[model samples]
Target: MRTQFGSPIDYFLELGADTIHMNELLGKPLHMKYVGQQCLNCGKDRKIYRMGHCYNCFYELPQTADWVIRPELSKAHLDIEDRDLAYEKDVQLQPHIVYLALSSDVKVGVTRKTQVPTRWIDQGANSALEIVEAPNRYLAGIAEVALKQFVADKTNWRQMLKNEVAQEDLFEFRAKLSQHIPEEVRPYFLSEKSDKWDLDFPVQKYPAKIKSLNLTKTPEFSEKLAGIKGQYLIFEDDTVFNVRGNEGTVVEIFIS
Candidate 1:
């Protein structure tokens, strides 16, 4: 699943040798048939261990390094290597931001500076604001860890999908949270004008109840496309399928 931030985020489902324009298919019938799983890393027909990777690739690839989830473990600044020194430095040594976003609720998170809006979109954030900017991922992670004690670090996906978010004053929230920053990373806190980005989704209707689709359980399904939000494709019957969650699943799709 590829996403572009627009008035309502634009989504594209990338199939082999083809791309399906999802927004255009809303309100129409779509048929999808799951064929098999293809390891995104090794490109072999194998069971997906995590994020489309086979077990071997999941354990071997530098992309799946432990530091990915625990940014505090980042050692690129110290010239230390986890899996690959070059790759670690290229990613962890770059600028990163600590942010507050409103999804189901306001939550704290961190991401590379360049991934600003993209990260928020993937998390289905209705709005977001940057609170701090760090020279590297380690400092950003430190900020996030400190803020976690005061605010939640995780988004409630169920509430997010229900579009049941409450309004929050991010500007005020940032000011209060800034005081809690660790002394080591306090200098990196951003004081610029915080801009709140309000995002919309291309959905004719939001489901009152969400029924998730599992490709592994049911190999084929067809339904009328109702909408698209985040990485999910909404069906008329309130059933939603997460394209990114089933990344390595090989499927044939027909939209009409």
Candidate 2:
């Protein structure tokens, strides 16, 4: 049959068409039906496509998986911060994560808004994702820890710190973070002379064995996140990406 373009040639020869259409040249192009399927998580009947996941399931998956592995494009969110950190300026800012992928391996890191990409690139991470949209610095740090657990690579945690700390604040938290790591990984993290601020919680080393944490297995207690049903994703480190929408946090939500 003649195509919509009216080329008068076989439609099957096109890039994505089937040869069967050529066999019956006079027949109309086949019309497929759309069947709704139940959500994998909540068993709610819904439409599913591509890999048994509905549209809602798709976006919930990490958009940064590739972006984190390459950080240059991701640094637009922090151009202003870069200037501040380089000038040794004192700025009280919320923390964010520099999600990294080193030749396909995952790394999770924390930084003040300005120093994140600079810090990641210095740590041998050629690619990175900056989670600049988090609620606060502490929660951003928590997201970093979660991402590290998800990626499940301490080597990614090889170099990370809560920057913008004063000498007294550094003195207070250094003893805590130092207890967990060797002296080698501590130097790059020392706060600048004019910097002031600190982590409320000491950087806790995530257990190596628990790298397989899956959000699918964790029960959902929050009502807001319930709409995010039947949608699950496994990050580079195998941690299941859970849907936890904090106040003012923008989650690219999915519903199936």
Every model's TM-score: 0.97, 0.24
Q: For candidate 1, give the lDDT of residue 216.
A: 81
lDDT against true structure, model 2: 0.31
TM-score of 1: 0.97
User: Model 1, which residues run further than 4 Å from truth?
Assistant: none
Please write out the lDDT profile of model 2 over residues 99-168, one tens digit for every residue.
Answer: 3334124444555665643443333333344333342343444444434444543442212221221122
Backbone collisions counted per model: 0, 8
Model 1, CA-based lDDT: 0.88
Tens-digit per-residue lDDT, 10-104, candidate 1? 98888988988888898999998989999998899999989889999999988898889888889999998899999999999999989999998
Provide C-alpha RMSD values for all models, in order: 1.1, 21.5
